[model samples]
Target chain A: MTEDTKKLLYVMTNGPENPDKTYAPIYTAALSAAMEIDTSMYFLMHAAELLKKGVAETVALKKGGSLKQFINMALENGVKFYVCEESLRDLCNIEASDVIEGVRVVGTSTLADLALDADSVISF
Target chain B: MRTECSREWDTEGELMAIINGCEIPDELHYYLEGSQMTWIRLDGENATIGLTDPAQTRAGRILHVRIKAAGTSREKGKPVATIESGKWAGPVHFPVAGTITRVNEQLELRPVLINDDPYGEGWIAQIKVTNQAEVAGLLKADQARTRFNEIIARDNVKCIRCQK
Candidate 1:
């Protein structure tokens, strides 16, 4: 892949329940936006839990700043969020109806394909 | 103040080691300062290791630290640890072959400790070196700086934190 097309970002880890671990996806998405790249956040493993609409809000209420707000900002700025179907089933134990709006449930094969296709694949 | 470009060696005073352009605080001693990379040599038959200042700056805030357990034998160039920052997670190869004796438990509490104090509290692992001869293959402070500059130039790495 060409350097220009290498903008996709993959995040396979869970969002922070603690304050210290909060910067990973936050700064990463911000950096991608700064670079003006076509950013994609792939939620897999324990990471799929972040896509639950109320979950971010709940964490925000506890932490003071809205994680949902940050996610919304990313979404409004054109960050594509994808939830892995297999991970959602196995790890999250959730059905399609349980997820937040605007999330696309995709197979594990798609993740591999995207990783291979993207010019750069960064996992947090 | 102007930075000196001259390559002059200070052969008079006591040897103060530096790593990747950053001063290795007097409390710490250099174990393996190979090229642009440097690993902290911990005390005892087992030694703890981690990235140096220049490395942490280039990589950004560390997010995750994946390590192997005690008793596992590892080879040089083999990934002894895997660290993830904001954008990347990759293997950190060792300079010497050894068996892992201990891993820093502090990393589980705060992985950013690696970025916070790489030379101090953020040490990665303790290894019992199987071959002490590999220690001779490493570099020192002055050489490390030159090699680091070369690497940044070769990779075309723009320093986002510090403007070149």
Candidate 2:
């Protein structure tokens, strides 16, 4: 709703297994930012793997172009992006160094912070 | 309620149209004094403002609107509101200096009215004039009609979907 002026947190937990699911976070995040709403997304579990270098570049959703294009579209509009640290290690044995530039890898405490600050949470 | 700066809305003027399909209603005041896309309608010292038809057509389907709050003072050419489509985002600049009286609340849920009816329900804001002289600089109906026709010809743009 346009009257909602609070922050939004989108949890992008669905990874490339169902490629169609990956686009909604970026699409919605960017549109919200354009409307001047505060918005952010968290990459948890398998979705954390998407931030691994070379992963997003290779993943194309049903919408055609690379998913990274959509991710960049969100970033360009100022939607903050974060990745879960535990998921990087537990799910894929990936490290913070492996993530692409612009994505911040943080601990679960950060996710908690996001959850507390957000007025709405969306699980994608 | 007509004033030195206010002109009554002309029903006959609404019938005039650009040969190429741009609808520059004769009664609406096109703000030629600054950047040219915003239109104004003066009712006494108050006014309603919105994008010109060509502007809405150019923007495509607007999905969201964020207008300045009521009681905010706007300077000429400053943003009074902003709108976005999936592919584009831009501000709707004020045509004259005034204090905002109201915004179209319905736009929160249905911004496409900007594309559906640029002239009527799509109006972005109502302002209480603080400077009537600024309003004086606005284009009158005959001039606005001619100027908007020229705008359509020069920009080579067609009016998009509009109901009445």
Number of the top-ranking candidate, with lDDT as the measure = 2
Which pairs of residues clash in candidate 2, taking residues 3 or more apart in a chain or in different chains? none
lDDT of 1 by residue, A1-124 (tens): 1266557766657653553444457546644543345678788886777777577665543323456655655564456788898888897787867888877899988888777766688887
For model 2, what is the error of residue B132's alpha carbon versus the real structure, in angstroms, after optimal superposition?
Answer: 16
Error of 1 at B2 (Å): 22
Expressed as tens digits, the lDDT of each residue in B32-111 for candidate 2 is 63324778999998999998776776555677889989999968766688776644355576788898999999889888
Q: What is the DockQ (computed on Cα atoms) for candidate 2?
A: 0.10
Q: Which clashing pairs does model 1 show? A: none
Candidate 1 residue-wise lDDT, B1-164, digit = tens: 31321111122334434332444444433433322254657455556677766565555566677777788786776656766553433456666788988899898778877766777787888888777777566555555556656554444333222211
| Chain A vs native chain A, TM-score per candidate | 0.81, 0.91
Question: What is the TM-score of each predicted model, taking all chains together?
Answer: 0.45, 0.51
Best by DockQ: 2
